[model samples]
Target: MDTRERYAAYAERIAGVSPSYAAWARSLDDGVVSVLDEVPESKRQPELLFAVARRLGADPADPGALRALVQEARPALLGALTSATVQANDPRRLAPVVPLFAALAARVGRPLGLVDAGAAAGLCSIPDRVTLDYVVGARSEVVRMHTASVEPGLHLVAEASGAVPTPAAEPIEVRARVALDPNPIDLAGPGAFDRLVEAVPPEATDRTALMREAARATLAAPPVRIRGTLPGDLDRALEALPDDVVPVVLTTGTLVYVPGADRQRFVDRVRERGVHWIALERTGILSGVAATLPDDVDPADPDAFATASLDGVALAVSDPFGVCVRWLADPNL
Candidate 1:
């Protein structure tokens, strides 16, 4: 009936479906729990919450039950909240979601050039070169933004199996005049730092460990060149692009934070530029049953009553967690 009761029911139902998820639920720290607790009841849509919870290993069969459990556990969960902040405040959380964008980019046969609106610490500024190996079957040139002595520019190259060839011999190109931002964000609080640490998957290897470490160091000692700019200011950045360029705009879990007017203006700016693609992931509130339930509830004639829109369009609509894969192709070219 109440919010706390609803969350408790949700958790219980999830534990019932997949016992493994119970372990993950228990493993979540107070900081993480705090995030779940603060989700406003008005914005809390059962289906999206269920889908995300399921993806986090909650039972899929009875998502409503999980919703009830979480609702009931609200106070205890709130007590666990170390800080009142969104999880995206930490950049490492965005790592897992990057591949979805990359795969989508590759699917449409377009090379991606990312524009991070918040661009905090540039965590998502440059695509992690390692992800390309698994999805795109290649490596990207790592843009060195930390050092002023080293030329700042984009490198375009392919790596052989488990080997890093000399930059001179490879297809690497250096632009001496390109601007570089060395300063990122100063995330000194324990809550933010711990989240970054916990986000690293257990399967991470020596290279991933090194990369994460480097990212941490960069955050600690950001380059003086680093600067913060609003999403609307990107119009100049877009206009400066060369005539031959086809840019793909991407923001992961960042768009929703922007005010509606800014978001609309940013979209219009991109559209006016005739940009090739715009990819983003945003959260939307919706009811769990209404969003996921089958169109035809009639058990007697299942096939005849089945939904038509599911297959017609790649309508992978989940209520709370909106995983969007859309692109606006340049109509003129």
Candidate 2:
């Protein structure tokens, strides 16, 4: 099968494995069917398309009807295709978009400090200066790297491995810098190994799980405490910051996990601060939030994160495998 066909098959298999994913696949398939009627006959391929459509309750066996439906729903299908591409290439899942925030900070003459709201193991927290090199086949390439620095007084506390004893309170007034010397370790073996494992056809050994454990071992190490900010209660912790300090709220893979209302509230709070909010979150969550924005509101504005203010905020979407990066900055700011 060709690349697109393989991807379609992978999507189908993934849908079968997870119910949540099945729902997403069904939604997309339904959309595809609804717009299929407008699609040209040359583009119609009921067998391949129906395999995908069936996941969303379409009759895959009815090739004739499916083709007719596809043609009738071409416009919506086209839109769905665009959305899928965007969703597939979301920057929140990747690390390349992290540096754009630093560049923006330099442009705005503001101090660059990152707060990863849903920082899972803080793997993407590495400074922009450190290049994450990955080997694909014979070529060694730099996937993405940034030279940006974490803000002063930034503390990251996660569940420790051994019995180090959790602290009573978060650490305060500490200067934490990204370590580049150790080099970004992959321990997961090959480049794109995680993605490969994830895209593997059915019956593939639980390689993804194994890779996760290995990544956890290599990536999740000692938690750092700086400036008294703990992982939990980010908003409350940030509010206590000294008046002089300007904060940039950032997160990736954490926003989608949060409820829609809660995410909006968090964004609103970030805007209230009148500082930069760099969010590297899943495209799905971003799209959902963007849909709710007022028609007059321009998401590209620096104050877009806030409900009623000019506070600067920027969003960068990352891909699911954490590879590609797409940035959305406030043009007005």
Candidate of highest lDDT:
2
**Taking the tens digit of each residue's C-alpha lDDT, what string does model 1 give over 1-333?**
554444454445445434443334334444434455576532333323333443344343342434444555545434432222222222332222333333334444434444444444444444333222211123443522111122222122222122111111111111111111212244454554433333222233432454455455445333222243335456544444444434545444444445566666655666676653323233231122124334533322212111111101111221111211111111111
lDDT (CA) per prediction: 0.35, 0.36
Off by over 4 Å in 1: 1-113, 132-230, 236-245, 283-333
Best by the TM-score measure: 2
Question: What's the TM for model 1?
Answer: 0.37
Candidate 2 Cα deviation (angstroms), residue 160: 36
Q: What is the lDDT of candidate 1?
A: 0.35
In the order shown, what is each candidate's alpha-carbon RMSD? 12.7, 15.7
Location of the lowest summed lDDT over 10 successive residues in candidate 2:
153-162
Assess the local accuracy of residue 169 in candidate 2 as a C-alpha lDDT between 0 and 100: 22
